[model samples]
Target: MATTVRRTSITLPAAHLGEENPLPALRTPADPHQVHERDRAGLPADMARQIGYAPLRSLLPVRRLDGYDRHRTPTDLDAIVIENDRLRATVLPGLGGRVYSLVHKSTGRELLYRNPVLQPADFGLAGAWFSGGIEWNIGATGHTTLCCAPVHAARVPAPDGGEMLRLWEWERLRDLPFQVDLWLPEDAEFLLVGVRIRNPHHRPAPVYWWSNTAVTESPDTRVIVPAEEAWHFGYQRSLRRVPVPRWQGADRTYPVRGERPADYFYEVPDSARKWIAALDGEGHGLVQTSTDQLRGRKLFLWGNGPASQRWQRWLTEPGTDGYIEIQAGLARTQLEHLRMEPVSELSWLEAYGPLSTDPDAAHGTDWTAARDAVARGLEAALPRSYVEEAYRAWLASADTEPREILAAGSGWGALEVLHGRFKLPGTPFDEATLGEEQRPWVELLHNGRLPTGSLDVPPGPTLVAAHWRELLETAQADALVEYHLGVAQWHAGDRAQAVRSWERSLKAAESCWVVRCLAVADAESGHPKRAAERYLRAFALAVESGQGDTVLGALAREAVPALLAAGRAEDAETMLGALAPGVRRRGRFRLLAAQVLLALGDVSGARGVFDAGFEVDDLAEGEETLSETWFAVAERLVAGSGPVTETVRSRARAQHPVPDAYAFQPE
Candidate 1:
């Protein structure tokens, strides 16, 4: 086939990405990878500056996505295929523009891991991420908040005058517009990707980009990068420089050799081409290379531990072969964000395809020689100069207008375009793209006031950037406006003012959403009792207003936990008991039930919850809640004989180990 772009469909056993949580996500990212003084001492000036650049305080304006369950059903998904004679690439426009598959036509080989199913897990920044495929991670240190969300996709003219698929969206985190243009030349094997992030704002913004590519994991496979040493990070909460290829007692190049999940950020020299590859025993696999702008490469190994294996299973179907990520980014580590100058932009071209080399050299004992061999193979297939030339050639056509729409994304970009009056070419966020979610903000932009009337349910997400705050400040105040303004104030770190605004909103009209936001503020500000009261009140209001089941469920999840934390065991019990059977059976609520029952001194009842096992479908990464809960229940059981102390607690924890089914913590 010549270069072609066409619509297609994929069917998989996928769980619905359920409704986004009505509750706001107010907490900051759990940044466990902070640079230590010892590690920072040897950094270069540019690296140091980028590492210390702006970091996010919270996920603000983005909502959490814990609403999904573990139910899987065969479903059809809309996909777009951009293919050439030698390679066929399938992209999922609805799922963060994820490239789901890349096939080598002549060899009948799949270059990417091609996950067997789509099972949402609590991994993305805002929640709900799945493994495998190529994920475009752009936002904070974690996976992109839009990992499970849709992005606008359209067909545009490629540099070769062939049709190319362009994926673009307005990134809410940094208030920037970005586009990913993917194309393949008629006779080319490499699928070229042109990425551009434009900052239309007057102020500078911190930008993060990581192209995460998951490849099939086999013991015979080895990852090769140009750097001799890498910044290694694991669950130990520390980063240290270590020699690559060989580490500890084993050759770390083999992903399965790792006993625990870890990140090896290759410190690729600025003089070297930015590329990474995972080659098998036969020296055949995927290779990713980009123009010099994307300077960092990483090898993320899920390890062979039970927890790692279980997580892999959780992400897809059982018996599916494992996968590891070969990633490229803008900085040395995901924890760092580069500073994009105001009114300026950053763009880079990346190519992904299969590479083959002599098996002996690829799997050689000499680390340097082994990497050199793969690099030679990559240079032969797609030379560094050729990639640079391609980048330069593609620049001219980067701004070509889209000829047809393949899929539509959220209305956020359209709203942002209206708000900023930004003149973005090539990738347009047309006013027609605006939907119900953007209607209120659209009104605010046109009428200079946020329309307010609906109080039956919770309010939609509120933008918290400085510009939106300024607009709200100038607009008239009402219950709905006040609620949104309070959220914006809260996001700006003005807790006192936020509370006052919510109070004013309450005086105007009672709103479960406003009360819930207040509860969150109080809960974090060391007013657990007040937070509990507010949560309960919010729940009551939700019920009285006949809010959606999702809203009621979300409120209960927060309220019972708050009540229990505040030592209101009876209230917590009552709230937990009042929930419908179906709601109570949700994995999150089941865990809460055990905790609430334990607090109420219903030891046997709590034990019953354990006997009737349940899974917290959205167990967060790095969370040890399952182990902690098990121990807490065990400690309560130990107290039955007599008063339990620290010694008794230790014995209880030692006596009751976390079962295999509940083991998800990195070992």
Candidate 2:
């Protein structure tokens, strides 16, 4: 379907942007233009001050890995400081509407040019990033880097009250030596990243450092991750792939064409295990980095943008205008992993590597490169992958059945939704498999006490559907048990019986919430539109009843889609907009808004909403999904209308359905 491309860059009217968010300043500039400049372009800088650094470029101190140097020298540092060279930097307005800047740091002999005007607010001060503010990091040892300048400058205490560096510098110091310098050629073809952390403060610093990398956001850019198994839906990584002895329900494990719109993070094997890596199609490259050594570490992946906007971008297009980023882990997840595996506390850990562009590059054009790189790099960057290798034998003792799934739905039907068909691997996960505490909830579902929200609430759908012949009599209500059996029958492709059971369950329901659960059940059962309406109702009821944030979040997820399916964008926008400011703290809201805005083809606006919302959630690869979606939307808009160029469309088309999942078929 073609779309009309509006040449007019979507802008938030003055009113849409309320008060500025209180983002901590990174460094204080002498001229203060650094702080004043921001996401938007169009400001008059004093001409004399604009070129003020030209004469004294040589005075700027050059930062090196081991120590500070006076001049840019040949070293294995991420960034080097150039002292006393004429630095020419200008922010010029571009035809595309963003402000392009040509920055010449003569001391480093680097010409860093960027369209700085198009800054996404959520691209925060972390990792080796571009397209954000200009910032650099140099540690007591290891790499130094000269990155894109930041829109805002921050303040840091001077060593001798001379001057302050950027905010990121302090953050770098606080999280000192997170990475180690790898084999960098004199010309520095690639800046090998290393990360390390030590508890410097008297109190243990709660930190989670997620490895972050951004790729050209486009539909053709597929991601390939190596794992024994992946989730049927949602972002959780499975330790072992769910084995599908038989396809059950609507869930399938392997995707047919490519990866779905997902934010899944895996728990990789330790160094002792054969290393695995994630690769992109076309065999461009693959990198493998893991915290196999780090205990308690949880991985994160997400896709979103800006705050809570009405537009939504689905990540199923083919294109190159957008970007995808991978963040290792945040302080919340990383520190816990470190705490659990104290013996693995080495500053640097090999997370993963991207495949090299050269055909003769070490790992060749195989997935093994990713794993091999991790094995080699982790000993220095991340020592944990190596240390954890010893415990592999122990974990094997406590094993459970794996889940296998495949993707069989259309893009629109699947979209941002995650489907996890919980089929037990070895043991049948029937009512018996459910824990005692969970049994009551199961009974509630069976008894029609739980609201279907948007899914058909079945008591023993899996049990009755897949292995009904193995059913045994239990000490449960006869009607409830029978209703469950019916629901299970429905799940196992017995729709007629499922419907009858649902009707019976509704008649037996004690409360209206039970009916709501039925609605949820329906939605989960593929009736998204109906599920949406029920969710809205449930949301309203929850609001009236003063339901907690969790409940509200669930309702919002349901209601938004219902509104979308009902063609209630304006209403959804209003409701979501109203709920956004208050519930902006909720990750789901941010993601939902991003989804909507992407649908509206408002990529920039969607990004703004995701950015604002991400400050609270730090959605991680969630950003990648959103970025890819925008690229897709951009392509669609360009093709249908004409606001975006053909070049943009072509690029985007090459990047659709990013390879984010891996499926291995038997030989």
lDDT of 2 by residue, 1-667 (tens): 1111111222211111112111111111112012122311221233123222121111011111111111222222112121112322222111101112212233332222222122222222321122411122222111122232221111222212221111111122222212221112122122222333433232333233444343333233333333333322232321222322112342221122213333333333333432233223343433434443322122122323222111111121222133343334422121122221321333433323334332232224444453354445434433543324413421221122222211011111011111113221111223322343244444344453432332222222223313231241232434454454554454344556655655665566422233445564666477876766665665566566654554455446456866766666665666576563657545546666766776666766765663453422222222344445445554664565555577866766575432222011100
Encode model 1's per-residue lDDT on 337-420: one tens digit a residue: 988889998999999999998889989898888888988989888998999998998899888999999999988998988888
lDDT of 1: 0.88
Q: How does each model score on TM-score?
A: 0.97, 0.30
User: lDDT (0-100) at residue 418 of candidate 1?
Assistant: 86
Model 2 stretches with alpha carbons more than 4 Å out: 1-496, 510-529, 544-546, 574-582, 594-607, 610-625, 628-667
lDDT of 2 at 587: 52
Task: Estimate every model's Cα lDDT from 0 to 1.
Answer: 0.88, 0.33
How many clashes would you count in candidate 2?
A: 125
| Per-prediction CA RMSD (Å) | 1.6, 24.1
Candidate 2 has its poorest 10 consecutive residues by lDDT at 407-416
| Model 1 ranges with Cα > 4 A deviation | 31-49
